[model samples]
Structure formats: structure tokens, C-alpha cells
Target: MDLSDTQHRLLAYLREHIARHGYPPSQMEIARAFGFRQNRSARHHLEVLAQAGLIELATGRARGIRLTGPGTAGTPGDGLLQVPLLGRVAAGQPIGSDPEVRRELTLDPSLFRLRPDYLLEVEGDSMILDAILPGDLIGVHRTPQARHGQTVVARIEGELTVKRLDTGGAEGNGGHLRLLPRNPAYAPIEIDARIVDFAIEGLFAGLVRPG
Candidate 1:
């Protein structure tokens, strides 16, 4: 639906607030965010948003703003999906697992063409040639298996790594698993699943880059 610039910002902020904090912002919070002197100013904008059918507000609740239409909850809509942004996953070396929820990111479902289960923040340049760089948030779909040539989130000996999967060649390092890097500067990691704890955590879906 068509919306004024202020309405658009309000909706976007509402979505982000809900995604990050698990609830809508109060009128006071909106007023403070938009530099309005009174909470009523924020309420006025919300009323306009509701009239435009962009949100549904509960009459008596403090945090009642609910986004409606194409990019929010309710029904089988092609709206935004909340994906947990996880801690850094190494592209250079195996990193200790600390999969904390940094925040929730609201992204359009069609952006990935797959329902991503989470987001892993890149910490190194191992996959830079593939456009996956440090500080990039990669959307991943949780899976135990990945096909050859696909980028995957894999755990080797309890450490997480992101790399391109190569399953076509004969077993290297006495195993059938390998984590290949896209950059020419980095070497491939041959995994001996027999000796190490190995598993495919997820498949690469898409990326969210810094602005």
C-alpha cells in the first residue's frame, strides 16, 4: 500500500522494533524516536497508518501496533520472516561455538527463495571472492546435508566454519568431507569425519550486507 515517508519510516521502525525486542513500541517510544514533543504526535501517525491499512492497533493495549498487509504476520502472507542473527562463523579457521542471538532480522521471504532458519555473521575473508565477506550476515537454512558446490555451514570437531562444499573427489585427509574456500589465498580444509565431530549445520541462503 502507498504510504507517506513518515508512515513508511514508522512501519519500518515498528517491524525492526518487533523483530529485535519481540514487541511493538509504545507511543512514547515512537514519539521519542521521531522527535515529537508529545506522545499524541506518534498516535496521530499511527492512526493514519491504521487508516491506510498498514497496521492494526489494539484499543486498550500499551504496545498494540501490528503490521498488516504484505510484510507482516497473519495469514499465509509473503511477509517478513524473523531470522536469528547468530555470532561470528569463521571463514579462515574453526571457531568455538557461541551461537548467541545478536538480534532478529526481518527480511522478505522471497529474498532468499528459501526459508532461512538463521543468520550467521561472517568473521573472515575466506569466501570474499564469492561476495561473502567479513561482517556480512548470511541467511542459512538448517540442514544436515548439502550437495556438491553448494556453500554450507559446517561444524568440524565442534567448531563452526563456512565454506563451499566439495564432495565429488576421493576422500582427502582420510575422510570424505571438505570445506573449500572461494578465495585463492586460502587453502581448503579436508575433514576426517571419522576422527572429528562433523556435521552440516545449514545451507547458505542469502546475505545481508552492511550499508
Candidate 2:
């Protein structure tokens, strides 16, 4: 659906909220912000925004709205977020008791920070065409709110997947996240909430290839 002027205002408001708090505004919050008398009235706008492909339900909880768009990556900005690639968390093999931090990678800090806790690695040929060859380094945001079109490190059924994220907002609650691959040989992975702990390591904002 084409966004009306009011919807554009609402979407801009929502984007500000996300930039301020790293999350979307709630129905009540949006209504309060926009001065909507009824909750459903606010809901109507949010639903419209979702239909327009602006946000999605990143979390199962209500108001799990997340911005779906291109992140501030490779924007000629110098602000880089550096995280350690601790070590490889095997996707095709068993994970040991713990892994080691082998190297450090620089990325957009606005996306996420790499602490002693979280780590990620590229696996499989799904995103090969995207230059995410198996064993390549992928920067992770360690966030659950990965917007659509952003590349994410997803855990599905206890297995890890790196693909372009496609969200369906609240309507896709029945299970609506598709892990799209850059390579057409592999089919996109649809995530159902029934299996693993689905989490976004971070938006695949950047990558580093060794010479």
C-alpha cells in the first residue's frame, strides 16, 4: 500500500523512536505521541506501516516492532564498531564447551558491539554469491531485532543460518521470517517459532576478506 502523508509522519516518528531507544514505539506510545484517542486508531496506522514494509515483529511480544531498511553501513562514515571473532562456532559440527577469540574485526559500531560474550562466523554456500563464503568472517549485532533486507545470523532449530532477513511484522506471527540466500541454488530458510532460539547476531553490516 502506498504510504499516505499521515503514514509518512507516523513512520518518521517511529524511526526517531528506534534511533533514540534502538526499538520501535508501542501502540499506546505511538497513540500518545500522535495524540490518537483510541488504541485501535493507533493500531490502524501501525498496521498500515507494516503493510507498507516498514517494520516487523522482531520479538514475539507485542510492540516488537523493528525498522526494516538499510542500516548505516558503509555510508562513508568513520564510526566503526569493532568486535572479536573469538573463534569459530561450528555450524556443521558440534560446539565444544567454549571457543577462543582468534581475531578482531572492525565494523559499524552503530550496528553492534563484539564483547567477550557473543561471536559469529559465515557458514554454507547460501550467501556465497554475496561473498559470504564458508569460513568467512561476519560481524554480528547480538540483537534479536533484525529488520528486513538486513543480513542476519539466525539460529533455526539449533542450527545457524546467515541470510538476508525478510520479516512479516505481527501478521507473520504464525511464523514468517525467511532466510534468503544470495545463491539461488539454495532455497530460502523459513523460520518457525517452534524449533530453535531465533536470534539476530546482528545486521550483516560489513565483511572482511583476507588477501
Candidate 3:
């Protein structure tokens, strides 16, 4: 379809939302995201998309939108990646990692700067300053090592947490390693490998915000 720039953006957002959340965004959510004064504006855009055969909408449903055009089925041939949603991890203090696979999210590779091996639901606001907020689904690239200043998914004493890696500490000399938080309200986590088990599970790839 010959979509306008705003229509194209709205379509992309709809695809991303459905891929990330397993459902389309509500009209109110769309209105807020697009800065529309009323939900009617969002509805108008959706109706245009629906008329173009890009999406199918159901009446009497809060999140009734569905993708229907070419490359919208989220298949491998459509250039979509199926990344597993592997439970929750803490963005505040270290929390027990839930290794269970909740569901698979079909996402566009362009959403992340780096390709992610899996997705994790964050559960704290410690990384808010870094734009990783509570309930955000963060993309994690599986890796045993990460460079300094890079955000990493680390395990300390079997619990997982997301933080910026600071190897500048005595860690280079086999001492304590630091997991720095973006928010100053929370203190950085110091890992004493001699006392607690510490390992870098993966590097932070990118994230998909909840709609």
C-alpha cells in the first residue's frame, strides 16, 4: 500500500507490538504513543490500515488488531526472528533467574542493535537511568564475556541481574568485580568471586518496551 509516513510508522509499531506482546495495542495505547488527543485519531489510522488490507480488526475487543499483509505472518521466510522469552531477571537487586521458556516472540532483527539469543522480562527500576525499566523485555545476546561499560546479564551466587559491567575494580587482578547500576539510588553490586560464584551469562543486546 502507498502508506503515508505516519501510517507506515503506525503499521510498524503494530507489528512490533503484536510480536512482543502476543496481542495488538489498544486504541488508547496507540493514541498515547502517537500523541493523539483522542482515541478516535488512533481508530482512524487503524481503519485506514484495515482498508488497505494490512490488518484485520475485530469489533468489541480491546486489542482486536491483527496483521494480514505480506511479510506480516512472522515466519522465518518473512525475515522475522523467533526469540525465546526466558522468564524474568532483575533490573534492581539480583533475583533468582527463572530459566523456564515462557513463550517465543517473533521480532524484526532491526529492533535490536545486536541479535539476541533470548528475551527476559525485567523486574526492577535500578536500570531506569539506562532506559531499562521495570517490566521491560530486554534482549540478551548469549555470551560468557562482555567488554567493560557494556550492560550484561550476570549471575552472582546463582541469582541473575542486569547491570553495566565495571571490570576496573580489582577483578582484573582476580579480586572483586562490580556490577554498576544506572540509578544512583541503588548501590552497585560487588562480586567477590572468592566467596560467591560469579559469571557473565550474556551481554545486553537491546530491549522491547511493553505497550
Clashes of each: 0, 8, 0
1 or 3: which has the higher TM-score?
Answer: 1
Q: Candidate 3 lDDT (Cα, whole model)?
A: 0.84
Top of the candidates by lDDT: 3
> What order do candidates take by TM-score, descending?
1, 3, 2
Where does model 1 exceed 4 Å of error?
Answer: 1-44, 56-67, 70-76, 170-174
Cα TM-score per model:
0.72, 0.47, 0.67
Query: Which window of ten consecutive residues has the lowest lDDT sum in model 3?
Result: 73-82
Of 1 and 3, the candidate ahead on lDDT is 3
For residues 100-157, what per-residue lDDT tens digits would candidate 3 score against the true structure? 9986665666667788999999998999999999988899999887778999999988
For each candidate, the alpha-carbon lDDT, in order, equals 0.79, 0.58, 0.84
RMSD of 3: 6.9
Q: List the residue pairs that clash in candidate 2.
A: 81-107, 81-109, 86-100, 86-101, 86-102, 141-201, 141-202, 142-201
Top-TM-score candidate index = 1
Model 2 TM-score, 2 decimals: 0.47
lDDT of 2 at 97: 20
TM-score of 1: 0.72
Residue-by-residue lDDT tens digits, candidate 1, 182-211: 889889998767787888898999777754
